[model samples]
Target: MNFSAPSGEVVADRLSDFGIWEAEYRQTLQQFVQEVIQQAETDLEQEPAPSRPTDVDLQALLDDLRAEIAATRFALQQYRQSLSD
Candidate 1:
């Protein structure tokens, strides 16, 4: 065991831990993205289809709203996780 620098075994352990964290973080992000897409589709379906509203870009608005909700939910989840961590 080298006191001045960490041994290869310690470095390897740290790398493994980082890999696990990265995998978990990626999974969470992927789930959030899918949820956002699904929510946008739901919102579009629930929106009222007006006959005279030709200028209303529903898809664009829905996309924006979906992104906003996803970001908010992601941050909230991260905050909650941080508290536990």
Candidate 2:
């Protein structure tokens, strides 16, 4: 019954089942792949372009950063002194 000739259609039935399984598997895989591709494309499109350094004032930015650092250091020193007291 399970011969190569499919004496009682046994082998033939198995072949049919295999075919159906392959079709479903292929379709599901394709759908998953397409969804990932679409989402990646959408993310890329929504993201903004990066800023160029030439477009900004380097000196002004450096000054601002230095001021912020000084302020933070002062705050930290004040807090530590308060804790010691």
Candidate 3:
């Protein structure tokens, strides 16, 4: 007699693949965050002493960072939904 495999095995395989992808995605995201932080710190440290007022460029940098963080949050939410499904 021949035997057949279980349906759940397919799902388990998919989940395993997803888990690996998720780990890599998380690592990449973390590296991006660290780089952003390092860039901000370096920019601040390179500034001249209190002789000048705050620059508009700093505000632009902050806006860009906020947009990136918002995008990351959206991606995380989608990933959570995929895990549940």
lDDT of 1 by residue, 1-85 (tens): 6468888999999999999999999999999999999999999999998779669899999999999999999999999999999
lDDT per residue for candidate 2 within 1-85, as digits (tens), equals 5556546688788889999999999999999999999999999999998976677888899999999999999999999999999
Top lDDT: which candidate number?
Answer: 1
User: What lDDT would candidate 1 get against the real structure?
Assistant: 0.97
Estimated TM-score for each candidate: 0.56, 0.58, 0.51
In model 2, which range of ten residues has the least summed lDDT?
Answer: 1-10
Off by over 4 Å in 1: 1-3, 53-85
lDDT tens readout by residue for model 3, 1-85? 8888768989899999999999999999999999999999999999976876555698788999999999999999999999999
Tell me the alpha-carbon RMSD of every candidate.
Answer: 21.4, 5.4, 22.7
Question: Model 1 RMSD to the real structure?
Answer: 21.4
Query: Residue 20 error for model 3, in Å?
Result: 0.8
**Cα displacement (Å) at residue 3, model 1:** 4.8
Name the regions of candidate 3 deviating beyond 4 angstroms.
Answer: 1-6, 52-85
